[model samples]
Target: MLHLRVVCPAERTEDVLRVLRAAPGATHLVLLRGAALDPVGDVVEAEIAREATDEVLSELCRLGVDHSGGITLETIDTALSDAADRAEEAAPGEGADAVVWEELIARTGEESRLSVTFQAFLTIACLLAAVGAVTNSAITVVGAMVVGPEFGPLAAVAVGLVGRRWDLVRRAAFALVAGFLLATGVTAAATVLAEGVGLFGPGVLDQGAQQVDFVFQVGPFSLIVAMLAGAAGMLAMTSAKSAALVGVFISVTTVPAAGFAAVAAVLGRWDLCGRSLAQLVVNMVGIVLAAWLVLVLRRSGSSVGGRGSRGGRATARREDNGRPLAKG
Candidate 1:
C-alpha cells in the first residue's frame, strides 16, 4: 500500500476528490480545504493499493495537479486496517509484482548520473580489489565486490532500453564507460605509487601459487555467473528486496577484473593484463544483456496485467502521445 498526500488548488479540489473516490483501491480519504499555506491549496490524503497506483497517478498528473500543486507517495510499512485489506483485494494484481514506473525511473535517474560520489565509490572499489589481487586474497576481493557501485548505471541502461528512453540509455552508457576508465587509471597510478614504497614486487603478477587467480581468468562460468547475477540484481532492485544485493555483488567479477588488470599493467604482466581486460568486458556485456532481457519480460507482464482495466486503453494512449502520464 502507498500513502498519498496531494495538495490541490482550490478550483481543482473537486477533480482531485473525484479521482480518489472513483478509484476502488483508494481508501481512508481525507480532505482539509484551504489548509495549505505555501502553495495555498487544499490538502487531500488517501491510502491507495499498489496495483491501482499507476492509473490513478496518471490521472492526477493529467489534471495538472503536479504543476499547480504537489503529490507525494510513501510506502505504508504497517497498516493494520481492514480497509487496507479490502483495498488490496479490490486491486487487480499482487502488489509485489506491480511496477511503479514513475518511481523506478526517478530512482534510476539519480543512480545513473556521473556524480562525484559515483566516481569515488568506483575508484575506491577498484583500488581495494587491486590490493586484493596483489596479495592473492579472496577476502579482499569479496570486500571490493560489496563496495562497488557499478550496478546502478548498468541497471539504468536496462531500464532505458525497456522504456525506449534513448537519453537515459546514452547517459548511463557514458557513465559506465567513463567511470570504469577513470577507476582503472586511478588504480594503475596507485599501484605505481605502492611499488615505489616497496609494497609490491616486480613478480607480484606471477600466476603460479596465486589464490585469487579467478579474478583475472575468464571462462564460460564467468558469463554464466554474470547473467545470473544481473537477473537477480534486477529483481532485487524492482522488488525492493535490497538484502539480495549483497549476494549479487559477490557473484560478479567486474571490479576484481579491473583491479587485476591495473595491477598487472604496473607489473608489466601483459598476458594477465589482456586476460583481465577480456574478463571485465565479458562480465559487463553479460550483465547488461541479462538485465535488459529481464526488464523486457517484466514489462510484458505489466502490460498483460493492466490490459483488463477500463481506463488502460486511455492510459496507453496518453503514454503513446508523450503526454502527462505520471510525469516526474
Candidate 2:
C-alpha cells in the first residue's frame, strides 16, 4: 500500500477533496484546513492500496496539485484502517501493469554512477581476480565475481536497448567499456609488478589447470547459461531481490574472464590471452542479448496504460521495423 500527503491552497481544497472522494482507490481521507503557515492552503493525508496507487497518482498529477502546492506519496507497509481494504476492492481491473520506466531508469542510474567507494571495491575485486587466475584459485575467482560491480552498467545497457533511450544507451556503453578497460589495465599492471617481485612466476601461465577456456569452442551451452544468468540478474534488480542478485553475480564469468585475460597479457602468453579474451566476449554478448530479450518480453507483457508501456510499445515497433535497439 501507499500513503499520500497532499498540501494544496485553501481555495482548491474542495476541488481536491472532490477528486479524492471520487478517486477509485482513495481511503481514510483526512483534511486539515488552514494548516499552512506560509499562506498556502491545507494538507490532506490519506492511505491507499498499492494496486490503486498508480491511478491515484495519475489523477493527482493530472490535477496539477503537485505543481500548485505539492503531492508526496510513499509506500507504507501496514494498513492504517479497514478503508484500505475497501480501496483495494474498489481499484480498477487487474490494477496497473506498467513498467514504470522513469522509476526504473532512476533506480538504474543510482547503480551505474560509480562512486569512489565503488571504484575501490571494483579495483580490489579485479586485483583479486588477477591473482586468482595466476594462482589457479577458483575460490578467489568466485570471490572476485561476487565483489565485482560491472553488472550495474550492463543492466543499464539492457534497459537502454529495451526503452530506446539513446542517452541512456550512450552512458551505459561508455561506463561498461571504460570500466572494463580501466579495471583490466590496472590488474594487468599489477600482475606485471607481481611477476617482477617473484610473487608470480612464468610457470603460472604455462599451467593447464590455471588456464581458462575461451574459443569458438563456444556452443549453445554457453549461450544458454549466459541467457539464463542475464534474465535472472535483471529479475533480481527489478524485484529488489538482493540475495538472488548474488547468485546471478556468480553465475557469469565477466569479471573473472577479464582478469584472466589481463593477467595472461601481462605474462606474454598469447594462447591464454586469446582464450580469456574470447571468454570475456562470449559472456558479454550472451548477457546483453539475453537481457535485451528479457526486457522485450517484459515490455510486451506490461499493461499499455502508463507512459512506460507506451515507450515499450514504441521500442517494440521500432525493433519490428529493423531499427537498431541500442544507440552507437
Candidate 3:
C-alpha cells in the first residue's frame, strides 16, 4: 500500500475527492480544508494499494492536480484497517508485480543524468579495475564491479525504451557513451603515468594478467550471464525486493572490461584491448535487451486483468511508433 497527500485548489477539491471516491484502491480519504498554507488549498489524503497506484496517479494527473498543486507518495509500513485490506483486494494484480510507470520514469530520470558524481564513480571504478587486472586480483576486481555506477544509466535506457520515452533514451545513451569514454581515457592516462615511474615492472601485465583473462574473453556465456544479471537487476529495481541488487552488481564484466581495455591499450596490446572492448559491448547489449524484455512483461502484467485511467490506443511496437501505446 501507499499513502498519497494531495493539495488541491478549492474549486478542484471536489473533483479530486470524486477521483478518490471512484478509485476502489483508495480508502480512509481525509480532507482538511484550507490546511495548505503554501498552496492555499484543501489538503486531501488517502491510502491506496500499490497495484492501483498507477491508475490512481494517472487520474490525478489528468485532473491537472500535479500542475496546480502536488501529489506525494509514501510507502505504507503498516495499515491495520480492514478498509486497507479491501482496497488492496479490489486493486487488480499483485502489488509486488505492479508497474507504477510514473514512479519508474521519475526514479530513472534522475539516475540517467550525466552528473559529476557519476563520472567520478565510473572513473574510480575503472581505475580500481585496471589495478586489479595488472595484479590479477579477483578480490580487487570484484570490489571495482561493486563500485561501478553504470547500471543506473543502463537500466534507465531499458526503461525508457519500454516506456517509449525518447528523452530518457537520449539522456541515458549520452551518459553511457560519455561516461565510458571518460573513464577509459582517464584510466589509460593513469596507467601511462604509473609506468613512467617504477610502479609497474616490465611485462608485469603480460605475466600475471592470465588470471583476469575472463574479463576480455567474449563468448556465448558472456551474453547469457549478462542477460541473467540484467533481468535480475531490473527485477530488483522494479520490485519491492531491492536488496537483491547486491549480487547483480558484480555479475557482469562491464567495468572490469573497460578497465582492462584501457590498460591493454596503454601497453600496446591491441588484440587484448579489442577483445576487452568486445566483452564490454556484449555485456551492455545483452543487459539492455534483457532488461527491456523484463520491463515489457512487467508492464503488460500491470495492465492485464487491471485498469488504466486514460489509456493509450493499442499500436504495434515500433521504434518510430511514437504514439504512446495505451498502457493499462
Which candidate achieves the best lDDT against the true structure?
Answer: 3
lDDT, residue 269, model 3: 88
lDDT of 2: 0.68
lDDT by residue for model 2 (186-271), tens: 99888888889889688786766533343223556767777788888877655445478888778777788778878888878777
Estimate, for each residue in 62-151, the C-alpha lDDT of model 1 and write its tens digit: 787766887777888889999989999998888877677666665666777788999999999999999898888889998999999999
lDDT of 3 by residue, 148-266 (tens): 99888999899878766666789899999999999999999999998889688647777856668889989999999999999999987777667777688799999999999999999
Candidate number of the best TM-score: 3
- lDDT head-to-head 1 vs 3, winner: 3
Q: After superposition, how far is residue 57 of candidate 2 from its true place, in Å?
A: 4.5
Question: RMSD of each candidate?
Answer: 4.8, 6.9, 5.2
- Model 2 residue 181 lDDT? 82
Ranking of candidates on TM-score, top first: 3, 1, 2
- How well does each candidate superpose onto the true structure, as a TM-score? 0.88, 0.76, 0.89
Q: Which runs in model 1 stand beyond 4 Å of their true positions?
A: 207-209, 301-328
